[model samples]
Target: MQDEVDAVQRILSALADVGLDSITFVAEMSSTGRSVLHLLTFGPAVEAGIGPYPGSLILVEGAVPEPWRRRPHPVPRAAPAASVDAALLERTLRERIPDATGATEAEIAAAEAWLGVALPDELKALYRVTRGRWQDWGDDYAAAERVAQAVGCELFPLDELYVASALSRPCPWRFAATEAVVSPPDAAVQGLVGSPGWIVFGDNGGGDRIAVDLTPGPRGHVGQIIMLDHEQNIGASLLADSLTNLVVHQRGDRQSSYRVDQPTAVARVNIQSMTSIQAAAHPGLEVLSIGVWDGEPLSLAPVTGLPRLRTLTAYPGTLADPLEIAKLSGLEYLELGPEEWRVLLDAGAVPRTLSAAGIEVHGNRHPLPIVALANELLALWDRPPISQTILEGHVEV
Candidate 1:
């Protein structure tokens, strides 16, 4: 018995350095008096390569006291509190934006009835603080909206709460038919359709939408927010785990809700003014489509490190030389603007290994001039005259 107690004491002392907080032990003794002890320790320092749930268990040969087999006493706790504090959120919003106004209970109730779904408690708390609108707080706090707009959605609007509520019958605005030009395959389309309970609340002023997914796809969870890009052929990319997370994020909390398991063809979307840090974080990108609304010259230097980049769509002023982009051996598709195409053709620097190559020309002008030139230049290479419409009447080849 002395030996058994000494062994346990020594074991506890050894584990003290590892932050061991609690220990439970069990023992079994044979008729010959030999015994075995099983000790389970909680709050131990997790070892390298350990999984999310970490703990330690030790087995020692000894006769332990019967008291060791009993369960440990329960820990005490304080009274429960709301996960989100409505008054605190309101205070924060008022501090940041003096014009912020919270939604009234009647407004929230009406909106919920129109949508035919109850808002999650956290989201309800958020609305009670602020209806849905908040000014761009700054770079860090506004990163979500910036990333959403870059991918395809317009400014994240809180007015969506009221507008979506008004258009509740049949929910025409609930789903946007993806343009056939950038649509995913039938299976992927079916997967998206399976989760038809998406409520679009805002747009990019173009046509793309930002929505809260009530019925998530196979790889997503309900209540998660996603961006639906109708123009770029990209389907849904998760933006936040929940509306509550989005609100928390805007308060300068750095957490990622970006989910990347979409169909490969429409999986990647480009962000304007991308930095090397952002590119390294999204190494799974399959397509890099640059959009520069500022008309300032863009650079492809930041994305050269992407190991999985398969498609390169270079807008005007994005590249100084075609070879600078052709150097990426993994790139399978290349789309270039007129001037870049001319430079590449002139220098014979266009990589012949590309699966598809085309020139992109923007505007509503007669395609005869550009089409004739495209055929002349691309006919020898056996490529198609791929033209995309930037606007209702403006075509980009």
Candidate 2:
């Protein structure tokens, strides 16, 4: 593990030398007990390839690989773009509200100075295109624009950063009551505890503020984008690894490979949007599925009170320990990602109770529509599979 970590750091250092900062490295132990490193980069991985390293390394740029790519699952389509460039930002803004402008370099610099922190490279590049302001510059013009009409302002002005950092004023729109939590304010002194090094960038048009971490937290790294929802008390929850990844998520470019179904009252619950409070509300859930993407590991502790939970499906990494699921006495089925499934299978640590129920491994199959697969799985459950002995005996009879 030490050797793998050293190798990864060397690779990152080499890439940084070549001016590549937007990247994510994940090192996992393979079924063979060898460390396998996966590199996710906004730019070309080929360009940052500093080879002659140990173990297997897969580099993915722009889009997800074939196996992991969300297949057959229909998602909102976004315009084609290699990376989060000025053109893509402009196009996204234009498609929603024509004539939307970006922030100027001076405005960006000013905001940085006011906040006492340098903006990330992706954000700096974005603001260099234009200074977010109105063309008409009047009440009528502001009222006419769709973004202003929807979000109360076309874009968060550079001046707002000053108010947000110093006074910690209320954010715009629905988040008007929510205070902007930035780095300058000492977490210990202010009694404002949660993310110690977050800088609010803009609002998501809802009550949530889109912020980035200047200081790395346990959940995410520095420059990693997080969603701050004061209303829900969700502070600096990992939204994406970087601005580029956030753009991809916003555009619905990255889709979940697994299929999902609408919420029903059959004790089978979809906890994609479920919060800790909401989890407590649904005490009758028999089966729970949590959709975890590239974010912090979600806590299953919230659902410990669910007495009837039989099946739990989520990314294995999300749990501190797979045994945590055993806390739910009734839990039967354990569905996990393909990689995780292999690891557990090799370790032979799968719980005896869970093994008695069944263990379903997701992935390693052709892309199937989620809805179709759900219906098929349900149908199979409704009428259990016949044993070969029964069929052979019937044929002889």
Go through the candidates in order and give the C-alpha RMSD of each one to the true structure: 29.2, 21.8
lDDT of model number 1: 0.45
Name the regions of candidate 2 deviating beyond 4 angstroms.
Answer: 1-98, 134-137, 140-154, 162-196, 232-234, 248-397
Model 2: how far is 363 from its true place, Å?
Answer: 58
| Per-residue lDDT over 275-331 for candidate 2, one digit per residue giving the tens place of the 0 to 100 score | 442443355555556555445565567677676555566654555455455566664
Worst window of 10 by summed lDDT in candidate 2: 386-395
- What is the Å distance of residue 278 in model 2 from its true position? 27
Q: Which portions of model 1 miss their true places by more than 4 Å?
A: 1-282, 293-296, 363-366, 383-397
The C-alpha TM-scores of every prediction are: 0.31, 0.31
Candidate 1 TM-score, true structure as reference: 0.31
**Number of clashes in model 1?**
4
